[model samples]
Target: MQKIIFYVVVLLCLVVTKIQAQETFEQRAKVIAENIENITREEKKILKDKVDVINTQLENKSITREEADKMKIEAATFHAKRIEERVAFEESRLNTLIKEKVDGKIQEASADSVTSKRVSIIEVRYRKGNGNGKRKEVIEKRTTSQLVLAGGVNNLVTGGAVANSKFRYWGSHFYEFGLTFNTRIMKNNNLLHAKYGMSLVYNNLRAVDNQYFVKNNDQTELVTSSTWLSESRLRNIQLIFPAHLEFDFTPKKVNEKGETRFRTHRSGRIGIGGYIGANLQTRQFLEYQRDGFEVEEKQKSNFNTNGFVYGLSAYVGYRSTSLYLKYDLNPLFKNNSADQNNISLGLRFDLN
Candidate 1:
């Protein structure tokens, strides 16, 4: 009889405790639902008004059936999105409430002298193996993007050159434009990343001392012209793929809602990378005097230029503006006596 009475008392206590925990959870759920209702009150009404307007327009023959159907889809999409947002908000609020309740119970138990002997309501409600562990929806962060533009002086560095065959290093020009996409490699961490994209690169090299290139069967060389040559330059256009391993030196920030956000300013940024390109076309421009008249000629050809080019590149910058440098590793002219490589140094702008 004594054992039976003890078991009955213990069972009653367990039932009462479960009831209390359930009541607490129900109260928190009610509060979260109320808050969600308040947030969506005006928005829901607006959605209803949109639906009514669409219906009235269709009934009055102000809109065609197809147009009304499209409008209806738009309205439904907006309402569905709003409802999803509300549900997410409610879920976050409920998690917060549960966490706070657990923390408060822990504090109260610690303050009591019988804490070692007592079990907390929160611990029982949210114990291990319980089905109440909710997975929070992850928020997708926005990625930084930009259009990159660079311009500078183009020069040819030769291993060896014939007499009067050097490149006009200062007068040459180079320019490139690219659309760059940047993605964060890790959540809330922006210390390292990969930057890659496609670019249109143009390189122009003007010869020195009124000289121009002539391509023979297996070689190309610079030769002097007797005519009064005003301008002569070689142009190369290439479609290039640029890839960089970049690093950010800025500190991370936490927003008011306790979410981590990276400050995506380009300050204190640096990158080292390489690019490979395919030659689109090459052309030679010549302007000279013939019979007391100005004559301009543009000759387009392969000119024995290499079909593929690749090189090393680097950049250092502050706030989307950087000093850029590139050096080609391979010779420009294939099967040529002169071994010349291209180098460019200039200012780069990253417009985001």
Candidate 2:
């Protein structure tokens, strides 16, 4: 009987204690539920406010309605998540406080204490990895071009014995002209250059001089002196080969001011070149002669001279056109009792 009474008393104490624990648990749960309900209400209210404001914004066509709605949803979700995190932190704090009551060693979390761990994320956009949109167009920095035009006239163009001392003659003043074709070969920020052309010349010649001759046949023991015999005229043509390397102020071509391609100028280049030509083709001039026994004035004819034409020309003149002055470095008459220099004033043209 005594043991049964002791067991019953113990059972009664256990039931009462369990009932008190159950009531405390119910009270705590009720408070947690109220807190959760309050948080949910605030979240719904925030969502409602965001939706209303976003709808107003979407009325403007600047942003699409779908885009505006997405922003509203994101804002609401972020706020709700914040509230949920706060609730979970509070619950954990309460549990820690309850545990701290049992042990003095455990530090209790304060209401003001918050989780100090911070998390952030950075994202990279891979718009290019999806696919390239378009191809870029390119522009050329260099251009192609050309220039052409006619130049001035020329006078005093010739090279032969007339300008020579032996068969000295000067009557006709020849004419010359030039043709040029030039294109830019190179160009930079500072300079421009061409592979060919500075000037080109086309030359013509005409002159007149009286002739006097004395021939002696030693074997025949005969001495004859010629009279003043005159010839009709003399004419010639020369192809002037020209080449020059020059520094120009303008990166363009220049025209001549005076004289033909053979006129000697005050300043210019002086280089050497060879030539071939036909001189004294039917050249007639004045002369005096002694025919055997009598000395008399007569018409001495047959003033035609021929052979391969070989000579050289010199240069002078610094501007654009060379003052056409050239000396026949090589003479035509081998042993015609005439060692002479033929000179003229003209222009200089660079062929290449």
Candidate 3:
């Protein structure tokens, strides 16, 4: 009686296994069919979108009617070919599933769960394309960054006059380097931007007529050096934060989705702003001949230079290069017979 019961149980287990296999095969087949249908529908939708964009271009007079017609025809052909290839790929997958079922290799699972996932992935990829089998270009970014570099002549205007300057025009120089961030001011417009960043500024001045900066009690003055000198330079190092309101004149463009986008640095731009910072260090370098020997002296001191500094700056140019100007709003030194303000004019480059 026990042997007869075992035979009956074995027969029932085989029947259940066969039924599950059949169900799995049918479910997988249905998933593939649904995927095929989805591919066709998605391609059609994408093609319609492309046509809409082309029509928009035609209405805007951006493209001639002949060009628009040609574009539409190309879009249709491309989508049709995509549909054919994709359907063939799905059919091949279905055939593979059928063969697996015949070989008793397909496992029992819910195929509907995978169907949506696969279809969604394909939809994302198709949407990224521009109906020409190529992905669309990225249109815009709300914020961008640049590496700022500037160098040029440096001088100080004494008594608000350049003619009374004590520094040599060709000998003195300034250099600046920093990283800057530029953000669009409006949501749908790229005509204006706010640019802000930090910078390290090195301002050097070479006094004229063999003169060097001297600290006289509570005052700073330029006195004649006793020794014949080849170099007499006073340098001030500063760390400053700069902010600007920039106006960009780059033309806007329309994307495949008929959305207007702005691209910067493609045309001329103007930036007007200011900077404020504290003096980091001040030093005077002297190179001369004394006692029939080459002598070099580096004097480190405050020399009554201003501790806090603020300046007005502006730039205007095409693309990445611009003519830059900066002028200090405060005196160069705290205690002095005549007030002298630092000024700079040079070429500035902003590399994105």
Candidate 4:
């Protein structure tokens, strides 16, 4: 009777042990399945984000549509491969757990701990994931930069009139190159902006007669050259800091998510502003015949010109090209009997 009772208890113990081992294997299998699903979802989300960036580049015209499509395909292929590899790893882990259970090596405690502490693939990959499991879209900055180039006719305005100017109208010219930054003024509005930058300005003037500028005492005057003159030009270079209040007419765009974005230099723009700087250098270039030989002379001097320069400027046009006008508020030369201010009209290009 005692032997039979002992055998019955032993049988019941074996049944309970088998049931616990089966439960552990099932729980581990469920955890592995969950891990595989999370890996697929996370990789798909990453691929979608990459495609969105490529599409934005296409829409901005930064890249061709064909290039964007190729980038998307590459991103998709890479993530797909990643998904396959990661899922295979999880499946291998599940297979290992099953083999352990068949060999009676899996611990019931280990399986219970896994169910309570399921591995998060996203946390393992991103580490710094934004807890919410969603990515925030990037937005355009409030301030942007651009390159500016302007060149056109330059002349001096005497008594506020271009017709009364003494310099040759068509021969005089100016060229300017600079870097500028544009900032949106209002938080939500895109119509108004503040533009500021630094520039190097070159202004040239040619005398109507065969003449050149000469410094006499505290004054500078244009005098007829003694030799047969072929060319006479006065060039002044300045370092200028300009600032303007710009009104942009480019219509604001709303994205699919209904977020407002300001796209500048896309349509008509008007800028009214001023610049203040100092004259860097002044030189006179003369090309003429001296005796029987051609002579080229470059004379570098202050030429009694104003050291401090300030001017008012404005531009109006569509897109990047604009009709730009600038007028000096100060006299071109100091202590001169006739007051002459420098003026320029040109085409300005503000390239992004």
Off by over 4 Å in 2: 1-172, 177-233, 244-310, 314-321, 334-338, 347-352
Report residue 232 deviation for candidate 4 (angstroms).
0.3
Off by over 4 Å in 3: 1-141
How far in Å is the alpha carbon of 186 misplaced in model 1?
3.1
* Stronger candidate by lDDT (1 vs 4): 4
lDDT of 1 by residue, 203-282 (tens): 88898888897888778778899986789999887767888887867667676666555655434888899999777778
TM-score of 3: 0.61
Scanning candidate 3 in windows of ten residues, the lowest lDDT window is: 117-126
- Model 4, residue 23: what's the lDDT? 52
Candidate 1 stretches with Cα past 4 Å from truth are 1-138, 160-165
Hey, what RMSD does candidate 4 come out at? 32.5
TM-score of 4: 0.62
Query: What is the descending TM-score order?
Result: 4, 3, 1, 2
Q: Candidate 2: global Cα-lDDT?
A: 0.34
Model 4, which residues run further than 4 Å from truth?
1-135
What's the true lDDT of residue 342 in model 1? 80
Q: What's each prediction's clash count?
A: 1, 39, 0, 0
**Model 3, 1-352: lDDT tens per residue?**
1222222223222221111113454445545545655676677789889999999999999999999999998887787667757865865675456446547796644434333322110101113577878887443447776556677789998877877678999678887756677888987777898999877678999998999988999899889988888999999887788999999897787768776766666579999999998787789999998889999998989999998999999999977668899999999999787889999987776644
What's the TM-score of every candidate structure? 0.59, 0.29, 0.61, 0.62
Candidate 1's displacement at residue 20, Å, is 62
